[model samples]
Target: MLIDLHKATLLVIDVQDKLVPAMADPQGILARIRWLLQVATELGLPTVISEQYPKGLGATATALTDAAPQAIVVEKLQFSCVAAECLPESLLAHEQVVVCGMETHVCVLQTVLELLALGKEVFVVEDAVASRTPASREAGLRRMRDAGAQVVNREMVVFECLRGASHPRFRHISKTFLVGEQP
Candidate 1:
């Protein structure tokens, strides 16, 4: 199913300052997530940032916060945002969720599972998530897909949201964000 911008919320899970340096392709993943956040903002989509125990992991990356300054930030101890019960009502009010973050095998995977269980349509942005090792990242992506979450890339999410070139933001988005991207 296409990701309906009106019904979807972007959930950035634990892309914290301390945790990011330990992930594989940390900079690349952050770039993708940052791009997604910027596009989400331009499209006027709601976004939620989840930090796992900020005292330890630190807060969401500075770049991400700057990209979507209006995003709601939630702090949690549980790997799964649902289990932590820390998700704000604003996030829960959405029917579909587009997710990206660090440590794909742990927090990202767990959150995807629980969100799926809750009957929410979950989309895991593969290129926007990673673990310290490539193996773990692959495992996490496989598990998430096996569990029924749609596995997609950042560009896919953006295009799905735009739906078509006729969309008012399409040309601007293409020139601003999709210029160098490959289908």
Candidate 2:
């Protein structure tokens, strides 16, 4: 199913500061994620960010927080964010979720599966998720797909969300968040 921003939210999973630098190509991942937040904001979609054990791992990366100032930052001991207080309730009205973040195998994968089971249309940005080890990251992507989450490329999601140039914020979103186009 196509994700409608009016019916969607962006759930960034565990892109904590302390943990992020260790992931491969961390900056590239967060930059794309930050762009997603900008586009989501222009579309007026809400955002939720979760940090797994923030005390130990540190809060979310500074750039992400800056990009999504109004976004809710959830601190959770549970690997899956559906267990976090207020988050599930806040997301109750949202039927579709666009997810991106770190440690793909452990937290990101588990969260995607749980969210899917809860009946949300989960769209995971493949390029924006990672694990310290490439093997686990690859495994997580496969597992999330196996559990029925839609594995989508970044440009596909952006264009789908934009729908057309007639969209009111089209030029602004394109100018601010659009990265280099691929072939």
Scored by TM-score, the top model is 1
Task: List TM-score per model, in order.
Answer: 0.96, 0.92
Candidate 1 vs. true structure, TM-score: 0.96
Estimate every model's Cα lDDT from 0 to 1.
Answer: 0.92, 0.83
Give the number of colliding residue pairs in candidate 2.
Answer: 0
In the order shown, what is each candidate's alpha-carbon RMSD? 1.5, 2.0
Question: Candidate 1: where is the Cα deviation over 4 Å?
Answer: 181-183
Could you give candidate 2's per-residue lDDT for residues 77-100 as a string of tens digits?
Answer: 988887654375667568988888
lDDT tens readout by residue for model 1, 1-183: 889999999999999999999987788878888989999999998999999999987999999999999999999999999999988887788999999997899999999999999999999998899899999999999999999999998888999999999999999999998887632
Cα displacement (Å) at residue 117, model 1? 0.6
| Worst-scoring 10-residue span by lDDT in model 2 | 174-183
